[model samples]
Target: MARKRGREGRFVSTVEGAEFFKVYLPQFSSHQIRIPPDFTKNFRRALNEKVILKNKDGKTWYVEVKETPEGVFLKDGWPRFVDYHGLKVGEFLVFRYNGSYSFLVQIFGTNGCKKEKFGPQNIATHVKSEVESDNDDSSSVDRSKLFKRFEEEEEDNNNEFPKRPSFVSPPSRRKMLKIPEEVMNNENVHLEAEVNLRNAEGKEWPVNIYTMLNGPTFLGRGLCAFQRDNNVGPKDCCKFIFGNQTTIDVKILRH
Candidate 1:
């Protein structure tokens, strides 16, 4: 029997029961609802109860309070664990926690039939701030807005860590490659190298080289180059072409 109190059928309006007045029907009890976003609210209050959030380290935990931080996760499993792992810091985690006590946790990330490991480091998580109070007619939450908030928070956390050296990408045809010419100018640097590119059929084609690093810079700046006729680079002579081709091995020998 759906009642007008609490979450119980919240003010059913339509005779078919599919619709309601004020708010949707509550699956829980009369005055109790799901937990508030603040985390301090009683998650198990009224009809809804605790939420089980799966962390990236492979374990589930009931989050009664959520003030620790968003990306936070528990790893290696906590002894006498409160479920399993908790999202504490570092990586971006998918964070499989029930958005609301009334609804079961659903897949909300890039996972497509991919058994989620909870939260993934460096990847972003989506949290929807989209819940409107049943009693209130003016206010409502949107999921998209919540996701943006999560991204901003993630950036703040990552900025505090040391920057890692990013690998330079090989230039494609028509792209200019910048190489450190200054470093090469120093004869002591001594890096003798040559590359010959051939087609998959073993046909040698004239290749071109555009940008070479003049030298290494203190600001971590280096040089690169582009590809053209009469130029040869590593990407050209391969066992297979990218996208349509498979990975091929290359043997470099000193004559």
Candidate 2:
């Protein structure tokens, strides 16, 4: 006798599902979403307990699948899962059931606003690209492009940091100081390290550190998380320590 073949992973979000996500899903703290009954029954019948949902960018979340009177539903981390991917009301989510209890989700955003390529991996790639650009003598990497990459990785979507501000006079904030040339220019500092700026309270803030072929180094795009956290404004003293070749500690001396 022939063995029964397993169900394949193919599911598309309907208008109803999109409506459910935008209209009502955000209201609940449980962060559960009702899976379409027909799709679940036909394609996901084997989902007995829980499953791991992963997006195209490799963000994974463990979601509980509960079989209830209404239908099979995904709970626990559903809301934040969608939010992290910047899913909107009109967007469509395509699900492909990969084996090993995971679903590969592809997001179809509205008006061609693709947010999938801007993951943490891309951020690392962006920094690496700068390192590559350092090879050519005539071409100088655009600082704006670097900042744009940082903007893409920013958690605060509403207020993306602007390009580095130029202050005509002293302003009301603490400013970040540059790392010493000895350390920044070291042959060892190319792409082997990730510098962290630490506050007085010992909070570590990560920043992208890369060197150019010319004699210039940038801490991060415009104003990085460290600057925002302590209100590092214009002309304030910001001190940093090279904990090691891989990490650096920052101290906001004054605001």
Candidate 3:
């Protein structure tokens, strides 16, 4: 078998006679999607219990594969994938097996065009700031005390730290951008508020945050203007830095 490096930097073996199958999602198909019996015959003996589903943009989701008399089906983690991509009934999905235990998936809407929301962006590495101090006796003592005090305060506050940087790739057709769940929970942003989106050039766009009754929070109202002014596209990745509850620094990375 021939080996090739994958996008995740791991070497994978090329499977001979790799195949592709398409599925048309019907009503109530969010929980689990069945794989065609004929398609499973291609590599049924070689199939693994767990498989990875990768989107066109290289984002991956691990789903459990169940093989029974009923045929093979994608189980756990499938619902989250459906919800994350906002899949609806009648949408079509293409799954191409990669010889390995992974499949590259592509979603198409009713218009027969690829869904722009599934076009993922590369997630940037988390960069942590390091504190520096002068190499002096008093400076060292002060730095040690500062760290101790910081740790004590963090413990007292239940170890809640500042929100880290995150990336968002908004769909071109969508008027609002969804803030990541981790960022929203960490920042305690659950109410409607007005915030400023500042770009790298110091240009600011006032955007309104709208919290849904039981859904995710989104940046709306002024997002279109911000996207227009920054020339944001579906392929571009925007890094969001939550400077404060009222300010978000955006750095657009063009492809």
Per-candidate TM-scores read 0.17, 0.36, 0.44
Can you give the lDDT of residue 186 in candidate 2? 59
Model 3 residue pairs with clashes? none
Candidate 3 — worst ten consecutive residues by lDDT sum?
A: 122-131
Candidate 1 per-residue C-alpha lDDT over 98-199 given as tens digits, one digit per residue, 9 for 90 to 100: 434222232323233323433211111111111112113212434245334434544766833132221122222222222234433444332212122343
What local distance difference test score does each model get?
0.26, 0.48, 0.60
Clash tally, candidates in order: 49, 4, 0
Task: Say what the RMSD of model 1 is.
Answer: 26.3
- All candidates in order of TM-score, best leading: 3, 2, 1
Better model by lDDT, 2 or 3?
3
> In model 3, which runs have C-alpha deviations exceeding 4 angstroms?
1-17, 26-28, 45-48, 119-255
Better of 1 and 2 by TM-score: 2
